[model samples]
Target: AEPDPLITETQGFAQSLGDGVDATPYGLPIEYESDVIRRNVEWLTADTISSINFTPIHALDGTITPQGCAFERHHSGAIDMSKDEYRLMVNGLVGTPLVFTYSDLERFPRENHVYFCECAANTGMEWAGAQLNGAQFTHGMIHNMEYSGVPLRTLLEEAGLPDDLDGKWVYVEGHDASSNGRSIPIEKALDDVLVAFKANGEALRKEHGYPVRLVVPGWEGNMWVKWLRRIEITDGPVESREETSKYTDTLADGTSRKWTWVMDAKSVVTSPSPQAPISHGPGPMVITGLAWSGHGAITRVDVSKDGGKTWETARLAKPGEKMALTRFYLDTVWDGSEMLLQSRAMDETGYVQPTKTQLREVRGENSIYHNNCIQTWHVKENGEAENVEVS
Candidate 1:
C-alpha cells in the first residue's frame, strides 16, 4: 500500500513555513484556482462597458457565492465611488423628499437573508438549442449572497408613503452612467425589497453594486439596481428603455409581455459538466447542482440520466430557503457509460421547471429573457460532457 503523500513524498508548501496572515492583508483564492473566475461572452455584447460576465458556477459549490468570483453585468462598466460621496434619496409622493448620506444608512436597523440574484437571461442563449458548451456559460448568470441591510419599506415609511397604496409604484434608479432605472409595484417594494449595503458578510463589491444596491429577491437581476441612488414613487410603471425595448419577452405574434419579474424555479448540474468534466474514472459519482426559485423556496429537485424518461429524487444538501439558492445532490455510482444528465426544480408553489420544448411552446423562440428551462448535458463514455438536447 502507498504511504500518505505528506509522510512519504516531499512538497515545498508543506515542508516550509508559509507567509503569515499579515502578508495577505486581504485574502484571495490560490494561484491554482486562477481558472475559477468570472467569464464573459464577448461576442454577445457590443462592448465591455455594457457587457456581462458569468459566474464560474462549475467551480463552486454550496449556496453562498464568493464576492470575488460572483458574476457581474456592467451596464456602463464598473465604477469606483467613495462612500463619502454617496447619497440615497427618497422622493416623489412622500411627506418630504429625504436624503441620506452613506453614514446615515448605517443608523437604521439591519436584517440579513440569503438570496439568489439571477439575470433573467441566465439560459437565454440556449433558447434555440444547446449553444454553449459549459454549464458556466449556459447557467452562470446568477449568484447567491447573504445580504445585510435595511428593508426598503423602512425607508419608505420614514418618507411616509400614502395610506392608499393602490395605483402606486416605485421608480428606482442607479447613479452610474446608464442610470438603469425600473419600476416596481408598491406591494413588492414594501414586501421583501432590500436596500443592501453588504453581501456575503462584507461590503458589497464594486462589481456587485458597491456602496449600495437594491436586492429584489426572486425578481430578475435587471431590477436589482446597483449603485442605487434614488427611489421615486409614482402612479404607474415607468416603461423605461430597460422595461420596454429590453428585458421584456416577445411572443410568437410579435407582441411582447412586460413587467415579468419573478424568476421561476430552475436548477443546473455543476460538476462533471462541460467546463468541469469528470477526471476520475467510473465509481461513485456525486451529482450536484444549484436549485432556486424567485417565486419561493425550492421544495424538491429531481435528477434524470436518461433524458427524463425516468426520474429519481435528489437530496437537498441543505434546507431550502425562499428566494435563495439551494444545493442539491444525488449520490450515485456512475458506470462510465453515456448519460443525458438533467435536473428539474420544483418550487414551494408546486410549479415545476419546464423543458426547452415546453418553454418554447408557450414563450416561442423570439424571447430574450426569463428562459428558465431545464438544461441537459450529454456525458460520453470518456467522462466528457457537452451541452445537448434530448428528443
Candidate 2:
C-alpha cells in the first residue's frame, strides 16, 4: 500500500503548541462538538417562552444526560430567582404553617439519587402514527441526573402532619407566572419525592429551575414542578387544571383517565434512527439505545431488526437503577440490507413495553399522554433511517 501522507507527514496540531488550561476558565464542549445541543421544533408550539426543547439524545451516550443539553419545558418561561429570594411554604392540614428560606433547606440533612424525569408527552406525538422523523424528537423529552436535596418527608415531618393519614394528598405549585400546580397522592409525595436544589453536582441551571425544584421520582415530569413554591397537605387531590385538563389521558370513548402519573417502561434505538444514521457501510456494527421505567429498574431490553418478528437481548452497559436511564447495545454485523429497528424494555415489575398496535387498540389513539408504545425506524441500504410504523 502507498504511504498515507496524513500519517507519514507532520500534522499542524502535532507541530504547534496547544492552548493553555486557563484558555477556558469555565469549561465547555470543544468547538468540534458544537452540533450536539438542545433543539426545538417551531411548529410544535406557538412561542419560545411557553414551549419545550429536545435533548440531543442520538448524539449522546451512557445514561446520565448532560445538564447543558438536557431538554427544557416551560409553561411561561424560565425564571431568574436568587437563593436569597427563594422561599418554600408548607401549609394546610398541618399543625403549624411553616415557611423555609433557601438557607433553611440547606441546613436539613441532604441526600442524592439519580432519577429520570420524563414528560408524559414524551412520545405523545406518535400516538396517532409515525409523526416525528427522529428518536430525539419522539423520545427526547426526558433527562436523568443525580439530584441533591432534602426529601419531601423531611419537610413534611417538620410541618407536623395529623396522625390519621388515609386518603391524603399534597398540592405543589411553582413560582413561575403560570404557577403550574399539580396534586400528588400523599403516599407518593412521602415515598421518594425530593426538594432538589442541585443537579449533576452543580447548581441548577436557570432554565432547569435554578434555586430549587421538586423531584417526583417515577412520576410524569409535569408533576415535578420547577421553582417549587408551596406544598399544601389536604384530605383529597386538589384536581388542579394541570391534572384535570392537561395531563389526563383521553380514551376512544372521549372519557378521560385522570391521576395517571407513572411513566411506563419504554425504549428506543437512538443510533441508526433518523438523526443518527449509520455512516459506515455494513460489517461490525453496533446498535445502541436507551431504556427506562418509572415503576422500577429495567430488568432486560430486547432489540428487533425485522420489526418485532424476532428478538435478541441487548447488553446493558451497567446494572439498571430504579427510575433511571439504562444504556443498551447489540454488537453485530450489518449486511447492507434494509432494517426495521425496534427495542422493547421490560422492568422489574414484569411489565413489558407495548407495541403501537397494542397501545392503539386499547387507548384508541384519542389521547396524547403516557404513550409508552414501541417505536420503529426504517433504515435503508444506503445507511439512512426514518421514522416508521409496522404491524
Candidate 3:
C-alpha cells in the first residue's frame, strides 16, 4: 500500500508553521476553543462567584493540562502579586531567620518534575447520589503539570537550620486573603517540597500563583499553598482551620480524622464519562485517563467494563520517571450496548483503592476529604454517561 503524497505534504506544511500567529505574548486558548473553559457548580460549594473552579478534564488529553485549563480553588480568591515584590520568609525555630526575594529563589538549584495537585475535597459531591450531573464536576478538581522550582531543602539550608530542629515541623502559609495554611513534617519539607515559580515551562498565570507556590510532591493540593509567602518552623501542627474545620475527615463513631495528608493512588476514565461520552460506534473503543499518587508511583491500574465483577489490567503509556503522572490505556471491543466503566489503582505500597461501599463502610457518609474510592460511570446505549453508584 502506497501512502498519499499530497496529504503528507499538507501535514508537513502545517507543522512548519510551528505554533504560529495564534501564539500570544501571554498565551490563551485559541478563540475557537473558548468554550473549553473552567466550569463550577453554582450551588455546590460556597459563594457563586468565589467558589471552586473545575478543570475541563473531559476536554483535555495526554495527562497534561495547559495552565489556563487547570482548575482553581481559593478560599479568598487568587491574589495578584508582582514577581519583583515577592518575598518568602523563613523564621521560628531556625538557627537564623532570613527572607528571600523571588530572584533569590532562582539563584538556588532548580529541578523540573511533573505531578498532579488534587483538592482534598475533590469527590465531596459523591456524598449524595451522583449529585453532579457531569464529569467536569465529578473528576475535574485535579490537574497535572511539569513544575520548575527550588527544593524547599535548598532554601531551608540557606536559612541555616537549628541543630535541635530535628523534631520540629514547618508551618507554611499563603499570601492570599485567607492564608490557607498547613503543617509539613521537617523530614518531608527537606526531602521533596518545592518552592515552584513556573509550571509547564512558563511563568505561572495569576490564578496559579504568579510569583510562587509550594509543590509538595505527592501530597494533597491544599498543602501545596499558592501565593506562598511565609515558612515558619514550629514544634507541632498549626491546627489551622483548613486542617481542622475543613480537610479533616469525620468517622461514623463520632470522631474526626485529622492530619491525613497524603493523597492515595487513584485513577479515572476521562472518556466515555459524562461530559465526554462515547461518540464513536461500538467496535475497537479506546479507554484512557490519568493516574498518580502522593504515596508513591502507580504500580497498576485495573479497568472494568462489566462492572467490578471482572477486571483487566491496563497498559500505562509513557509512564514517566517516579512521582510523575502516568497515562493508562485500555483497548476493548464494544458491542453497542449499555455498559458500566470503572478503574481502580494500586500503588507501590500494595494499597488498592477501595470501592465506594468499602470507603463508606469505614468512614461513613458524612466525611468529605480523601474520597479515593473506585468511581463508576454508566454508558447508556446512546453513549451518554451518568454518574452512578454501583453496589
Candidate 4:
C-alpha cells in the first residue's frame, strides 16, 4: 500500500493531530505566534515594576484587543488577588454609604458595551518629535473590548447620591499599592460610567483591574480606576496628585490646563510601519488602522500617502461607535515608490485630527500628554517604514 501524498507532504500542525482536549485547560494562541506579544521597551522607563509595556497593535487588527497582548501601565505594579477578596465601597456625599462584594456586583442589572481605553500618554512621546519607531509604541497604549457590568448610576442610586448635585464629583481609587485615584464630574458619572467586572466576555486580566474597574467612556484612561475599591461622592474635585502633579496639559505660556479628560479624535496607520513592514512587496496593498473620538463617533478618516499633499478617504471597515475603536482600510495598488503615510480622523462633531505642526503651534513642547496629532510613517522603497514628522 502506498502512502497518501497529502499526508506525507504535510508537516508540523498541518500533518499531526493537535494536543488532546484539556491538554491546556485555558487556551492561548499557538506558540508560533510568540512574536505577537506585549513588549516592554526597557529604555522607555526605569523599571518594569512601575512602568509600561507596548501592545503589539501593529500585529493586531480589528476592534477587540486580545487580553494577553494588550498593553499594561503600572504606577506600582500588577497585583495578585482573588474575586473573594474583592470589594467595592460607595460613600462620602451620598445620603447612605454602601458596600458590595464581587457577587453583589452581579446582582444588579448589567449591560455590555464595547469601549476603548487609551492612556492619555498614548502618543505622549511624539510631542517633541518622532521618537518611537513603531505604531505599537506611538499608539499602542489603547485597548477596546466589550465590558459587562452594572451602570454607575444604578450603584450611585444605591448609595443615594445626595440632593445637592450642583457641584459634586466622584473620587475613585484602586486597591493596588499605587491606589491610582482620580476624580470625575458627577454628571458624567450619572451619564455613562460603568463598574465593569468583565471584558470581552471574560473577567478582566489582573493587570487590567481584575475583579472590577471603572469604565469612564469618552474620558482619559486615568479615570478608569482598576481593581476599583472605593468611590466617594465629593463637593469638589479632589485635585489629587494624579490629576495635578500629572495628567494636566501644559500650555506654551507655562499655564497648565487641568481636567482635560476627554481624548480627542485620533487615528493612525498600523500596518506597513516600522515593526510591521510591507513584507509582500509592491503589489496590491491594504493599508488599515484604528480610529476613535472621545467626544463621539468617528465619521470619517483620510489617508495621505504624500505627507498631507494629497488625501484619500479610506473605507471604514464598519460603522464607528461612540468612544470605541473604528477600523478603516484603504485598498490600493502600490507602485513601490517611497511614501509618507498619515491618517486623519474626523469625529461626528466635525473635529478633524490635527497635524503635528498644527498642534505644536498651539500647545508647544512642554506637554507630555494628549498628543493626538495625525501620525506619519515614512515608507521607503524597500517597503520598510519609520516614524517621521511631516512638516
Candidate 5:
C-alpha cells in the first residue's frame, strides 16, 4: 500500500502543544463535533418561541443526553429566572397553603433518580407517511437525565393532604409566560414525581426550566412542567385547555381520546439512517438505536432488515432501567444490497411497538400525539439511507 501521509506524517495536533487547562473554563463539544446538535424544522410551528427541536441522536452513542444539546420544547421561549426570585406555592385542597423559597427547597432531604422525558408528538409527523428524513427529526424528541430534588410527596405531605385521596389531582403549572399547566393523578404525583432542581448533577439550564421543574417519570413531557411554580390540589382533573384542546388524541371517528398520559414502547435505528448513513463498503456493520417505554422498562428490542418480514433481537447495551432510555445494538455483516431497516420495542408490560399500518388501523392518521409506530430506513447499495415506508 502507498504510504498514508496523513497518519505516517506527524499531524499538527500531534507535535504541537495543545491548549492549557483554562482554554475552556466551561467545557463544550470540540470544533470538529459542531455538527452534532439539536435541530428544529422551520415549518413545524408558527414561531421559534413556541417551537421544538430534536436531539441529534444519530450522532450520539450513549443514553445520557448532555443538557446543553438536549432537545428543547418551549411554549414561550426560554426565560431567565434567578434562584433568588423563585418561589413554589402548594395550595388548594390542602390543609394549609404554603409558599417555599428556593433556599427552603434546598434544605429538604433530596433524592436522585434517572428518568426519560419524551414529547408526546415525538414521531407524530410520520403518522401519514415517512416525513422527516433523519432519525433525530423522527425520534429525537426525548432525553434521559439524573435528577436531584425532593419528592413531590414530601411537599404535599407538608401541606397536609385531605383524608380522602381518591379522585384527587394535582394541577401543576410553570412560571414561564405560558404557564403550561397540566393535571396529574394523586396516585402518580405522590408515587414518583419530583420537584427537581438539578439535572445531570448541575443546575437546570434556563432553556430547560432553570432553577426548578417537575419530573414526572414515565409520563408524557407535557405533564412534566418546567419553571415549575404551583401545585394545586384539586378534587378532579381540571380538564384544562392543554389536556382537552391539545394533548388529547383525535380518533379516526373524530372523537378525541383524553388523558393519554403515558408514552408507549418505541424505538428507532439511529445509524445507517438518513443523516448517519453507512460509509464503509459491504462488511461488518453495527446497527444501534434507542428504545423506551413510559409503561415500564424495555425488555427486548427486535430489528428487521427487510422491513418486518424477518426479525433478529438486538443486544441491550445495559439492562433497561424503568422509565429511562435503553440503548440496543445488533452486530451483523452487510452484503451490499438495498435494505429496509426497522426496529420494534417490547416493554416489561409485554406491549410491543406497533407498525404504522397497525397503528393507523387503530387510531387512524387523523391523530398526531403518541405516534410510537415502528420507523423504517431504506438503505441503498451506495450506503446512503432515506426515510421510507414499507407495506
Candidate 6:
C-alpha cells in the first residue's frame, strides 16, 4: 500500500517566522519544547538544595545542550558575584604569587573549544536494575558545548611558575560555598585545561559557573570546578573533600579508589528510549542519539536492534572534533513489534564501552562514579519504551 504523503506534510509544519525576524538577543528553545527540562532524581543522592540535576537527554537532539538546560551538580547552590568582585589568586609554589581580577583574565589570549562534561556518576543506577526507568534519569548527567576561555597554561606561565618547583602539582579551586578543589598533573595542566567563562557563545548561566569555570577537557566533571577563583601550584595533592569523601569510588574490598579522573567512552540511544518512544508507525524510522568520550573522539558507534545479537555501524551525522559529543543516526524500518535497542561507542584509543555486567565484573558493584556502561531500551507493541537490563 502507498503511504499518505499529505499526512506526512501535515505532521511536519513549516516555520512561521523567517530567519531574520526569528533572531533574538538571548536565544531559547522552540515553544513546543518548553516541557523539555532538567530533571532531578528525588532519592538518588541527598537534599534538593545541594543535589544533582539531570539533563533531558531524551528530549534533546544534535550535539549541543543549551546552557539553560545543562545539568548542574553542586555541593552548594550557585554562588553569585559581580565581575568586579571576582578575583583569581595564584599562590603556593609559584615564583611570584599574583591575583587577577576578571578583567585581567579577559586580557589574556583566548581560545574556543567544544567539550562534553559528564558527571562520573552518570548511569550509576544500573548497578541495580534498570532502576530510573528513563534516559533523562539514567543518562542525563551530561552536556556538551563550545566554551570560550583562556588556557590554564597561559595563566601558569604568566605567574612565573617557580624554577625550583619541580615535581609540583597544581590545585584549582572554586569560589562556591563548597569551594570544590581538585589537583591536576602538570602534564595535563599544560596540555588542554581552560579557565572557561562562556558556553555556547554566551555568558554561562549562574548554575553553570556564570562568570568563570575550569574546563579540564577529557577529564571527569568533578575536576571542572565551577565558580572558579584560585589556582595554587602545590607540592602535593590537596586531598580535598570532593575527592576524599565523594567522587572517589569505593571498591568491593572495602577500600576506596582515588584520582579516577578520565571518563570512559559512552553512548546511549536517546530516541526509542523512555522519554522518546516510537510514536510514528513502523516505516522509515530514524534512530538517533549521542556518543562521546573523555579520552578522545568517538571513532565508531554500533547500533543493535536485537539486543546485541547483531550489530551495524551507525552513521555519524556531524562527527565532532576530539573530546566533543558526536551525533549518530541509524535509519531502519521497525516492524511494529517488540524490540530491544542499544548502542556501543568506540573511542579513538580503540576502547569500546563495556556492558553493565562487564563493568560490574571489573569495577565491582560498589562504585558510584564513572559508570559508562551500555544502555538498553525495550519497545512495546504500543510503541512506548521502557528501560531494561539485558543481562
| Model 1 bad stretches (over 4 Å) | 1-7
Model 1, range 170-281, lDDT digits (tens) per residue?
A: 9999999999999999999999999999998899999988899999999999999999999999999999999999999999889999999999999999977999887888
Model 2 TM-score on a 0 to 1 scale: 0.98
Model 5: per-residue Cα lDDT at residue 303: 97
| Candidate 6: residue 158 lDDT (0-100) | 87
Show model 2 residue runs off by greater than 4 Å: none
Ten contiguous residues minimizing lDDT sum, candidate 6: 10-19
lDDT, residue 171, model 5: 98
Quote the lDDT for 249 in model 3: 88
**TM-score, predicted candidate 5 vs. hidden true structure:** 0.99
For 1-391, candidate 5 gives per-residue lDDT tens digits of: 9999998999999889989998999999899999999999999999999999999999998788899888999999999999999999999999999999999999999999989999999999999888999999999899999999999999999999999999999999999999999999999999999999999999999989999999999899989899999999999888887899999999899998999999999999999899999999899999999999999899999999998999999999999999999999999999999999999999999999999999999998978999999999999999999999998
- After TM-score superposition, the amount by which residue 220's alpha carbon in candidate 1 deviates from its true location, in angstroms, is 0.3
Model 3, residue 174: what's the lDDT? 90
Candidate scoring better on lDDT of 4 and 5: 5
**In candidate 6, how many clashes are counted?**
1
**lDDT of all predictions:** 0.93, 0.94, 0.85, 0.93, 0.94, 0.88
Q: Once model 5 is optimally superposed onto the true structure by TM-score, how far is the C-alpha of residue 31 displaced, in angstroms?
A: 0.5
lDDT of 2 by residue, 98-177 (tens): 99999999999999999999999898889888998988899999999999999999999999987888988999999999
TM-score of each: 0.98, 0.98, 0.92, 0.96, 0.99, 0.93
Question: Which regions in candidate 6 have their CA more than 4 angstroms from the true location?
Answer: 1-27, 164-166
RMSD of each: 1.2, 0.9, 3.6, 2.7, 0.9, 3.2
Query: Which 10-residue span in candidate 1 carries the lowest summed lDDT?
Result: 21-30
